[model samples]
Target: MSGPRIDPSLYRERDRIPIRRAILSVSDKTGLVELGQALAAAGVELVSTGSTAALLQEAGVPVTEVASVTGFPESLDGRVKTLHPAVHGGLLADLRLEDHERQLDDLGIRAFELAVVNLYPFAETRASGAPAAEVIEQIDIGGPAMVRAAAKNHANVAVVVSPDGYDGIRRALAEGGTTLEQRRALAAAAFGHTASYDRQVADWLAKETGERDRVLRVEATLAAPLRYGENSHQQASLYTFAEGRGIAQAEQLAGKEMSYNNYVDADAAVRAAYDFERPAVAIIKHANPCGVAVASAKTVDPIASAHIRAHECDPVSAFGGVIAANRTVTLRMAEQVADVFTEVLVAPDFESDALAVLSRKKNLRILRLPADYRREGWEFRQISGGVLLQTADSFDAERGSAQHDSSGWRLVSGEEVDDATRADLEFAWRACRAVKSNAILLADGGASVGVGMGQVNRVDSCHLAVSRAGKRARGSVAASDAFFPFSDGLQVLLDAGVRAVVQPGGSVRDEEVIDAAKRAGVPMYFTGERHFYH
Candidate 1:
């Protein structure tokens, strides 16, 4: 493994290295001809690989093929093109080091002042859902080797990995040469580009082979700088996953810039509203759902009606809350939405008239969901010294799908309910999971009448729900995210004239809870599945 001896004292320091020769090999042909022409006009030698050399020669630019320098033709379907020592030695030779210069001169290898390389489209090929073999072929071997070699010897060479840097490289060449600082910055960027590309390939291979990475490679690019963090005094920024389909990809149709809180509440609203099969709307405030509702079959304007009912659940809290709708926003929805002092509204799309109406409210943020948006993958939460990862809370109850399996549900007490009340209980159960625990939700006519969330005790949550619902709780069905430790919470709902209840019954005092429901003559169903959100 030992290759050569090092003599630090014999190495000289240089500020700017004149670029007399450049190696350019790119899979992306964008701006390649122009860069070649400019380098030729500047009297710089251009050495390129197969197709790149052909394109430059066709454009009337003088160029030398990499095969001519290596004395070996590109073999193994071009996979072995730039892996030879001639290319790497030229790229990695430290002209400041006397030994390195002597080795290059004795070997008849010309040192390259610049290396421009962009890897093949591995990420794009994988994203296109191409076959495994096709995706594998797009993983460039020689390109990364060249980029890393040039970046490692940044003191003697500059590397460019993207077309965006072509202009800067051209300007640097026009200025005689690139400064050491410029080379260092380019080296850092080049390494990052290769790192992200490798991570993508590794992650995809892991998924295809049904294996998990022992060491996670998390990568994100800076999307924007937020005005502040959770509070005004704190600093914050937004980093987006390159292939994410969540809030980061949402398009703002019309509105002011999104704040930190706006994105948080908007994301929560979207998740809550999309839980239903029918047209639904969820109003969220401070990362908690203020109200949630779904439209009935007879509704005239489904989204508008759902929004109206959801807002009515807690009109006071919904004043400046964010709204998310599962369906498109129509003119009717826009008119009703404009009447309220809302902060943000996100939906799949907006009708022409609806957009015109919503655009009038300059301060109201209007976001359109990405067409292919879907909730998938894992959820990550960071703690003081570690991170927690789990699969997302997803179910088979997607929109337009068959109803979720209810064979696991058991009617523990009271008489069996009609179809209408059963539908209400089902809606309440799904909505309750989105609320923070200890959570209690009341539903009637496919809409939330009251919601009690984030309480320390189930009994307090029950009381809060009843208090918020007032008279509406009389005929509403109740859903608890988890089982009641005692009968006190069920008693509270029963006392408010709640007609039926749905909960995950697994407490030691389950019989006691069942007795209380039986005495109230209220139907109680145990799903045996608990959902607790914190």
Candidate 2:
């Protein structure tokens, strides 16, 4: 007839868990000694296993071994350590429930206030190419289970999965106890750590067995939240995996926080820059290259000349484009970069004085990257209710060599091109791969003087490229990502003074197109390779 009376001591708001006892188990020993010494000084009891207990004891920190706490020796090559009822009871018992507290007391199990656990280095082991048996053994079962239990009951138990959390733990210890909010954050971090660990394990297993299920598992950690996506109305954030590359791992030296568009445009520009070995500059806008230029060997200042040549290609369109250089930025180059209305600038390195000069623009995002940074393995694209994964695009340096026989270029025109024209043809062909479909690029004097991309018809792209090139098109070479379906597209370039053309020629009317090029006295080479970007 009456509701059960509740114990006031069992339920309270805004209570901090007092650190009476903690379980410490980790494979990475970074900062472990300092943390154990601090916990011992605070009069908190620490229970550890194997090396952890021995290290703490040797450091003169009072730590109890797990065998003593559970009254059982570790078995199965130490795999069964910390899996006892005593450990789980201490971690999962709810202090706020009278029934839970009574059960713990009846069993003589002490409640653990905190748990520090870092999983085995499975990623490192896999990367090292160890034997399958050895790699599988490094996958920890007990660590994730313990951490998950502590995280699930974070209301009374604090869990730390990595040494990165040691500082916060120490600060909370100094303040006498961990706040509820702090405990919640630590729990979230612990869950993330465990999730990544499991994802990596799944990936390794899939690779080992040559999985036919095609089940995909991608693990990513949050890098930062952007102000907005491509538009202010949309929301977006950046992510990095355990193995990050390119802009995801780049170091930001100065300027405002990078936006969604900045990241996309910067990545595109940087990828384009590495396609060339010479000192080169690429200006990108709306995920397409507005202009790209490589420094001439004879130029007095290679970097400055590259920037000037690239900027001169389409000065109006380059207003707010992102700029990327493969080499370090000198003071002179920085001065040139500052003169433009650039949204972001990325390079391998920058001079101190150059950085000082560029810092004048407060909104310009500056990032430093390695000269050879690029993505590896698979790339993914998400669609409605599904996902697509494929190999990443890479520029093959051997494609340019004559001995490779990669493309099977055929002469369908006036005569073979000169060495300089051949070089320009190869350069423009590589740059065109990164542009959208129906793309055309003009290269001459070690610069991309003009680019036309995202066109519905091939003829229109040719006209757009010729217009952008202007006087530079007089002696420049052009590249097409695919075969020309009709002869009209070739005629447009011939009218615009294009001297030579390189295309992946496989059209049904290929003879007609070659006849048109021959009629116009412009040499055309068929690469027998097609690169399409949607």
Candidate 3:
């Protein structure tokens, strides 16, 4: 069936719509008084609801209460005030039609040329750990409805949804009215604001009822536009979530602006460094860890020692790599880093003296982690026709359990070592998770000696690790992110004089791998959990 059509002459083509009247309602009172006074000075009639009316009157701006226009008191705890025809009729009216104008005059309804609204803080209320009832009450009904009505009729009305738009609106009013182009832009932003608000509310309710898969609503605002993406030809920009601090929200203290590659490497370095409880440092290149190390028992200037040890694992790869430290960057660590050509350095903070020393390098990007920074929420990867989502990889389940502690791991071969060697094995297991699979990491004295990552096969990864370690591979403990599918990979490490090994041990050839370690008189432990970072 054909849809109903209207004559084109019935629609108005307005270049500018004068603000003869407006409805002001906001949960946030920022710039409210100033806006009200400006409207009064322009001889614009103001119709406001509840607290908005009272606040405008207090500021000595003439105003009419919504109750006066609706001819009924705000009932049901003020929820029914703006739902009446007197309010919506004005916002949704087609002023270009003579029939609509006659009906408005007969019903004592006046058309509104503008609407200033901001919804209740549903996202902030829920994030504050408020009770379910309290948070639910913050879900705005009238505000979004009014906003949608005004925005839909934006040909004759301008809607402002944020305080940041106040100055622009004021300037437009001073120039006689808002142009159709300006109104269209404001309408677009209004719809986006409401969409994000509804998404937040819907997502929270889904979680409350244990129906997380019911909907997936992602909202973000552009933080900045980069020069390019991974390559100069591709376009890229950074976007930040409404709440929470992450790489996008981190404060850049010095150096050049971050690039697409810099954020990726910086985030990987942070994940690798913060995986340990002790002071730790990680150096990353191309989203793969080149070096990772934790503090040793006998280290003075523990963080500095960790940086030096991490860098020594693969000094050549560490060049131009991004670095992350779990603790504050001190002068001792900064001095050592100043010698290396690094792309980015991220830490919780930097000591004053440390900043003074590192600021000399003009092109090195330095980022300070946000307060209470956390890596949580689902990780997303895009494919050709779909997206893959999973909970962020974390050690919460294995944090203090047998999986992270060597005492709880199943010893498949050889005798157990002392405290120091056990510490090395634990650090190796955790650090290997940050490497790309097929991955192998070798560590001694709580520091990585070599890392093999992003290889096609486990045997190749083993060779890469041993070759990187050189003589340091002797007596070093090795960790495989996943089980060695065959004995050949295990033999490579065993032949390299590796004294001990840790792996998930789920492959069908686990028995053969254990037998290989047993023949070499090396301790082999199974974590039963594999971390494959593709």
Candidate 4:
């Protein structure tokens, strides 16, 4: 298993190797022309392939084509251009080893001191629903090969793989080449780039061809470096996929930068807000909603009323929590929000006057999302060493679709369900879907009055909700994510003055629970569906 043994004599203290020649081949030519000019001005030879060389030539920078370097014309539609030994040997040579240098000289292989390569847009191509031929063509061969070679020889060669890195590379070369530390960092990035590129290709091929690969690979690029994670002791960064916009893409219009917990809790807040088509607001603390409320139609100032009622649900817990509104934030809403110690706020848009008022809170993190911003694609959650993927829970119970939706909800007992109660039950059920396990969500009229979660017993969750809502528990509809295994939970809700209930009623004691609802004179509906989140 052992390969070549290292010679201690080869180790020597020296400065960075002068970047004498660079091989540049990129699908993303951003900053390419300027970099070529800077390298040429610094007396560095530029060798490129295909349109890259043509671009440099057009820009008046001297560029030697790969065909000229290898003494072979590009064949197979430019695929064979950089596969030549002349291109790879130049990138992989270890200047520290005398034998490597001798082999390079004897074989007339030019050692490339720098390599700039960004591979074909395979991920973009595959994501765009491109045909098999187009996706196959985007599986870059020579680009990854050269990137790996240059990265493996990090001691003497510097590799650049991202356009974001172009400016720094140019500045380094112009200021006196790259440092050993920087080269090592670039080498690590290069390996990661090729590995991610290959992973995307593998994923696309396996899924498109219906080959169920056992292993899972999730790839994403760095979005932002967070100030800290959930705690000050931990480090964290944000990563985003190539497809759609997420919390990382939200604009920080006028506030301090968001931390790790801010992004996490903010996403929860916004999701709860988006679930409601009406003017809604969600107040979240520790990834759980403290209160969620929608403005009543009778309110003259809907946004302000939504915020005030949501905060009233649990004013103590709403303190320092993230708040999100599906509607534009108005000056009146801003004035009400400023009265509380809100840590973060997210809105579709903000009136200029609202921003003028909210900007006074220097520590408050405010974010603005496009009115149409919504998440698409799969949901991913990581365990110890693997990932769990599923389509997001886009299951919103249509206002009256419950009668026709497969899991058709029907009234099971007690008084006839009124329209107002039905609307409130729907709101509570939607909010309950977002709560943690053993959840019991209570809604008064249209606002989320109380939320009880993370309990081992359903009865205890009922107790928590009743206690949280206080007097508001009277006449408020309740939603239990799953069936009440025992009738005791239903009795507890009834004792707290809950008039109606919604739950997925399929349990060993379903008859007993329905009997309990009937005896308590409460209207109960069986959704024929359960929503348990942990």
Score each candidate by Cα lDDT. Answer: 0.91, 0.87, 0.91, 0.87
Write candidate 4's Cα lDDT for 37-104 as tens digits.
Answer: 98998999999999999999999999999999999999999778899889888988777888889999
**Estimated TM-score per prediction?**
0.92, 0.91, 0.94, 0.90
Tens-digit lDDT string for candidate 1 (1-534): 976787778879887878899999998999999988888888899999988899898999999999999999999988889888899999999999887899998999999999989999999999898999999999989999999999999999999999888898889878988999999999999999999988888998899999988876778899999999999999989888888888888999888999999998998999999888799999998888889999866978999999999988999999999999999999999999999999999999999999999999999999999998877577888899888888777445543223254556899999999999998999998889889999999999999999999999999999999999999999999999999999999999999999899999999999999999999899999988888888
lDDT of 1 at 396: 59
lDDT of 2 at 22: 97
Q: Which residues of candidate 4, in runs, are more than 4 Å off? A: 1-14, 220-244, 298-302, 370-391, 396-407
lDDT of 3 by residue, 439-471 (tens): 999999888999999999999999999999999
Residue ranges of candidate 3 with Cα displaced over 4 Å: 1-4, 57-62, 212-215, 298-300, 398-404
User: Candidate 2, overall lDDT?
Assistant: 0.87
Residue 42, candidate 4: Cα error in Å is 1.5
Candidate 1: regions farther than 4 A off: 1-13, 16-19, 37-43, 54-62, 128-132, 205-210, 397-407
Clashing pairs in 4: 90-112
Clashes of each: 0, 0, 0, 1
Give the Cα error of residue 151 in candidate 4, in Å: 1.1
lDDT of 3: 0.91
Candidate maximizing TM-score: 3
Better of 3 and 4 by TM-score: 3
Where's the lowest-lDDT run of ten residues in candidate 3? 396-405
